[model samples]
Target: MVDRPRKPSALATTPGLPPQPQVAFSADNSSVTATLPTGESVSVLLYGATVVSWKDKKGEEKLWLSEAARLDGSRPVRGGIPLVFPVFGTAPDHAQTKALPQHGFARSSRWEFLGKSTSESTPTPTTPAFAATATSAAGAVAAAAADMSVKLDFGLSSSGLSEDARAKWPYAFNAIYSVTLNTDSLTTNLVVTNDDDKSWECQVLMHTYLRVDDITTTTISGLQNATYTDKTTSPISSSTQSSPLLTISSETDRVYTPAGDSPASVPIVVSSDNKPKFTILRDNLSNVVVWNPWVEKAQGMADFEPKDGYKQMLCVEPGAVGTWQVLEPGDAFEGAQTIVLGGKTE
Candidate 1:
């Protein structure tokens, strides 16, 4: 059971205003949920700081979770947006990440819940993309706070790691992940700091799994003409995307990178029957991965739940995985991605 704060603060009950959004923790303190006054809500588990659920105002889920996903801290949650850090995938040839598990330890490690805050803002952030804006903007500038939003912060540091995980990657580092929920969108931001005396190299990815009515009716737009590495191909092939919209019919795993004058922050749309369903906008994250395990691959994964679940979910991940980022001691790297539901057409 979750412990919800039912007592409304005096200001929240003010005569003409709507009740402020509320954030609550589970009775066991293993997870937390934030609910907007309008009825949208999001929940995050401490293990890996994985977002387990995100519901719209009408209670429709936007993110998918595998039925077989292990939520007991035995492994990483297999859905929603799993944070991949230090390494994107298996790197047997790299000296720095060779010993670390695929996608590093961030996803499987437990994170400290730093707390929650609420604010009011417009749909678009000031910096546009890849930046942290005011949380509790309602408190700082009460007069300007109109539309309500909520944010939850989670933290992980080297000192909090288990003995075996610490031994594999000895660098001291700190990671902060923020999940911000608005009326019509969800935004996630990650900041990594090299806390060790020596510099280190790493990759970060927001591996987002979006729920859809049917995969066959879905098409992704915005990568046309951009170059992508087709990981599903033997020897891995790279080519420009010739189609304005891409669909998944078979096993697909391609990482798209911007080429020529293509901007990295361009809006990527996932549509169903030519109508927009989700719009992804990213900043400082140069790569986008479009993947679907399809039939064979989906059946082979132990935690993928029903073998046919692939038809109901798609992984449209925004990441900084095309190249490694080297951070100097005391330096930090930040990246963000925002997913808007029922996006507007161009």
Candidate 2:
């Protein structure tokens, strides 16, 4: 058995606020930072998270996660990894969506970060050294603190669940999300537990937005021969049988399933015409979703890119589709995905 390091000391908790357990870890050059309150964190490449945010470097009050990746620009500050549960995207029947707003209420909600001392079991592997590095970096933010990496946990509260959420889907469920940044990559893990007596069914996903210098010039692989569904058209089409590999042209929206049962370990390499490659490795996920609002649609989104901003980024999500996952009373379900930076291909 791999020797797990001792759990760090108790996190300093703020009175009247949810337990904000912040921890830190460090390796050599890279560091990670996590806040248990929001499960929000940052990985300092010593360079930048991914792309350099000119706005952030200038000391503007810009949201770090906003410029980092996965921050739902349109939603509240509880950003970074917006947890989409009970459903992803829109419901098959548009009428059924009236009660819910946007992407089913997890993003804007605040979560409680169960402190570091608490023991939790998860399907994914735990890297204590990496967690340490992350937390240590966070400490550096304070003038008197040391450099380290940290891992934080957040739990969903009844109050945190939005009114819109209750109107659309009424069920008791608890979700715990953790974000950990290591020297080489960022890992996000989500666990949902059903508290109600009846089994519940719903689609689940992690909407990840990646920052790039130029989307038009970036070439993304891993979907070659993989199957996908085009959301633009009501009737889903298979990219595998017809349009196998996907390269961004104008506007694109497609959901893909791995070619086989093997986890999608292959890097979804994204290379710009002249820049480095950003590799996305998805694991334990059933589907991959690629989307871009394009010209007219981009304008429709409250916080999406301007008509031309579509050329800056792409959303390649890892999710479960078509059928909704059913969780029985007291049962919990978990899934994980990873995004690694640097290392471009020729």
TM-scores vs. true structure, each candidate: 0.88, 0.66
Model 1, position 249: C-alpha lDDT score: 97
lDDT of 1 at 3: 72
- Residue pairs clashing in model 1 are none
lDDT of 2 by residue, 1-346 (tens): 8765895777775442233335553464333344333233453221112211211222321112333233322343322345666667667574434456556666555455453432222111254433444455332222112212344455674455667667677788887776654333556677888888888776667776666677777767666677667778857665562444456887788887767667455557666784445566765577878877778787775555344667776777777664677788998878777666555322
Give candidate 1's whole-model lDDT.
0.87
Best by lDDT: 1
How high is the CA lDDT of each candidate model?
0.87, 0.56
Question: How much does each candidate deviate from the true structure in C-alpha RMSD?
Answer: 6.3, 11.6
For model 2, the stretches where C-alpha displacement exceeds 4 angstroms are 1-80, 92-98, 115-148, 234-236, 241-245, 263-266, 274-276, 343-346
